[model samples]
Target: MVESLPQTRSVSAEAAAENRAWVSDLSSTGDRRELASRRLYDVLLRAARSEAGRRAARLRLAGPELDDIAHQAAADALLAICGKVETFRGDCKFTTWAYKFVIFDVGAKVNRHFWQRAGVAFDEEDWERLPARLGVGPEAHAESRDLMAAVRRAVDETLTAKQRTVFVALVLNGMPTDVLAEQLGATQNAIYKTMFDARRKLRTALIAAGYLQEHQPA
Candidate 1:
């Protein structure tokens, strides 16, 4: 059994065969690679459109604009996937892994679209969202003000400048990770990882400073 994959959702033999064929065709030379790429591009386009469809209403982008986002996402995903073809290990289905690429591009595109639609700029004013998440209340912690102050310091002093920017933009300003990534000229994966590290640092600082109540995961 693959430790990373649950046995419950086993990849059937037929599915595995198809995945292998995708790899073979995609990794082929000349015309084969071209044809395979076109096929994969179509699949990616559909996946991106589906992704956009799921969020069109929330992003308030529909009709041609949403389709345009999906098209751009598919093109981006195709380039990324083809450029990194050697990295496909076949641990998961080819389609499954490729889907992630499409999702990443689509997510970034959608996030930027949403941000543009909402006019959410990352500013000092956005920091307002952090304080509420940090403090419980006057009754929960007598030194709520100090705890909040400590959290602010932790945010400023503990995280790297980039980390601080990403966290503040995404959390406080309600800017999506993808949009923050675009503004920072970074990938969504990189921004998310930075956010993860920043959150861990903040959690430790908050717990140490007597702000958040720590509870072990069950």
Candidate 2:
């Protein structure tokens, strides 16, 4: 015959008191702190991942490089969080601050990749020379497949042949002034003059063709 199992007793008052005390101690220090830290980690990780994905999509990065970029961005975000942990005043949410770090890290990574691929040197001289090389402002010309043709026509109709060649060599081809001078068998000063004349003529042509507007005489 099978024996009957003994019934379990309810928790005694003393045991319950000890359990409550243990729980209170844990809540006062370890458990609460662990919960807070876990929350912060979760929020930061989520923000970093979101920013990484957004940047990758914006830059149209594909394959393993995209993953590497995102990983690097996440690592940067975590490092920033650790460095600024002392300054977390709890005024705003930690996630909000983390999001800014994540975005900045991802943007910086993307810029570095693009600059490297394009062979752009980041210096004051390079910055100043950029407009002469890349043309005017960001939206200086309309986006079209026939943009080069239109630009050529504008140059031919407005500028002399030598000025047009100088403009193309220096601006579109990213040739240095010294190199352009050597190629054209002219002095750097002469190249500069040709570029200036080409710019003026092109501006006039653009304004006349309604591609650009004339500024109020100032």
Candidate 3:
């Protein structure tokens, strides 16, 4: 036989009084206690499993694991509500405050887990600098990788040691002109000229390899 769920108690007068006392304590410094409480409740409900799943999907978190992360974030939000009750000054909506806390908590948890498993510091500044130094976005990144692979093949087929070293240092390593000069034992002006020539040659090679096409300026 199936068991029935237990009935919940209705809000009694004594319970209501106790709640009012708690709220009054929370609003001690002339804050909008009612609004803050309401907003917190709304945020918690919105971050329920289904809604969080949708958000996680948008953020590209897939499979059963993402649900676990969402649940963890929801729990963290609830804990924050209890711990940060005094800190809620109602300067902004409680929902906004709760969301910031939840996102930070979830991101930290994920980063920690990844670092432990991979044995690497994923938050390195150099990792962030790589993409910006490449002058590429996510879409451009894929294309850039493909172009790099083709260039490597072409380099193996034809370029000499000094040419390959200069090309890799300036282009792939994203070294600045001054740094490239230091490494090559050349003047900054000489490094700049070499880089310009290397780029021209690579562009011509890439065009021949069908990796690039000329476009007219608008």
Task: List CA RMSD, all candidates.
Answer: 9.3, 18.2, 15.9
lDDT of 3: 0.52
Off by over 4 Å in 3: 1-42, 48-60, 113-131, 134-143, 146-218
Candidate 1: clashing pairs of residues: none
Between candidates 2 and 3, the one scoring higher on TM-score is: 2
**Order by lDDT, highest first:** 1, 2, 3
Best by lDDT: 1
Clashing pairs in 3: none
RMSD of 3: 15.9
- Residue-wise lDDT of candidate 3 within 1-218, one digit each (tens)? 11221222544455444444444544444456555555555566456554555544323455676667666766777667657655544444445556777765555444333322322222233334443343334543456656556655665555555565565555543445565565457898876776566555655666677665544100
Better of 1 and 2 by lDDT: 1
For candidate 2, what is the lDDT? 0.56
**Model 2 residue 27 distance off true place after TM-score fit, in angstroms:** 19
Compute the lDDT of residue 150 as modeled in candidate 1: 80
TM-scores of the candidates in the order shown: 0.56, 0.41, 0.36
Instruction: Extract clashing residue pairs from model 2.
Output: none
lDDT of 2 by residue, 66-94 (tens): 66776677767766665655454333334
Overall lDDT per candidate, in order of appearance:
0.72, 0.56, 0.52
State, as a TM-score between 0 and 1, how close model 1 is to the true structure: 0.56
